[model samples]
Target: MDQLHHQSERYGTDYSLAICDVDNFKKYNDIYGHPAGDSALQAVADSLASHGRESDGIYRFGGEEFIFLLPGQTPSGAETRLVRALEAVRNLGIAHSGNPSGTLTLSAGLSAYLPGHRVSSERLLKEADMALYSAKAAGRNRLEVAPEVRHIVRS
Candidate 1:
């Protein structure tokens, strides 16, 4: 994250960070068992990695959460990619009785670092995390962008 921030600072390019969570993961685990939950997580991870751009960094952020670093991407561009990733995971057809859709789904929150913004990487992550919570609250399987970041980018 530090490296990406530095590069963005030096090159004047924008980048976006996203935090995603598997919807109803706990219920899925409770209903299916740990081994099945682990496999489901793996499938979701693979789907996210495959659907993202090669330049994007995808990492398991512990448990059912994952993080994405999209280099040279704006907030909207990152949303486009993340939406695709969400659909890819849904299309995996992993049964999740706990989920309303009866299939695995993902929800994500995104924040972007624009040039001359003077924002710290930590703040960026916090914003994304907050947005992630908002996504979950708004009903999972959707993407939410940090309102502050979006406002800045628009201006």
Candidate 2:
């Protein structure tokens, strides 16, 4: 919160945020047990951290969801980087403690700024949430840019 005020010039409100949630993770855990679920989440989080920008911050937004902040990036650029990172997640092929190998996938939502629009931090989160819902609706393991920002260049 302090950062938003103190670093206003350094960190413009222009940043975009993308939130990714693991699809069907609850079912996987309930069926496979918590240990496997923990392993999967850890593996995914590690991969995301490695693939993300040095300046971009990632957070565990509760169960099965992680948010990646794309500072100074346009919506399209955010999507592009995200698509690559997400693809990598799809291919991670981590072995489930119960399934032996090759388990789990993610669904992500992307929110970006429009040409003339500015959004508060809370609004930004909501937009990302909507996009995430759309992604899940569209089909799991896919990316959906916010409707308003879809035209923004991907990557």
Candidate 3:
């Protein structure tokens, strides 16, 4: 993330980061064994990876959580791609009776770094994390974007 921030700062490029978490994952693990949970996570990972562009960065943030870095993308553009990725994960048809959707789903929170915003990587991550929390709060399986940092902070 720091490297991406540096690149964006140096090249005056835009980049968005998303923090995605599997909804009802703990319940799924309790219902299905850990092995099944692992498989489900793998499936979700694969689906996310497949939906992203080659230049995008996909990584497992931790158990049941993944992060995506979309370089050269604005918040809205990243949202478009993430919305598709969210649907694709749901369409994977991985059963998760724990989830209200009756299948596995992802909730994502997105934040973007624009040149001249002078935002720190940590702040960007915090913004994304907050958005992710909002997504989960507003019913999972959705994407929420953090308010633009530029508006929140004056250079």
Top-lDDT candidate index: 1
Sum up the clashes in candidate 1: 0
- Pitting candidate 1 against candidate 3, the one with the higher TM-score is 1
So what's the TM-score on candidate 2? 0.84
lDDT of 3 by residue, 28-118 (tens): 9999989999999999999999998999999999989999999998777898999999999989999999999999999999888875455
**Which one wins by lDDT: 1 or 2?**
1
> What would the per-residue lDDT of candidate 2 be over residues 116-152, giving only the tens digit for each residue?
5455566667878899999888777788887656644
Task: Give the Cα lDDT of each candidate.
Answer: 0.91, 0.75, 0.89
lDDT of 1 by residue, 70-92 (tens): 99998888989999999999999
> What are the models' TM-scores?
0.95, 0.84, 0.93
lDDT of 2 at 132: 91
Give me the displacement of residue 131 in model 2, in angstroms: 0.6
Clashes of 2: 2
| Residue 89, candidate 2: alpha-carbon lDDT | 81
lDDT of 1: 0.91
Candidate 1 lDDT for residue 8:
88
What does the lDDT read for residue 20 in candidate 1?
Answer: 94
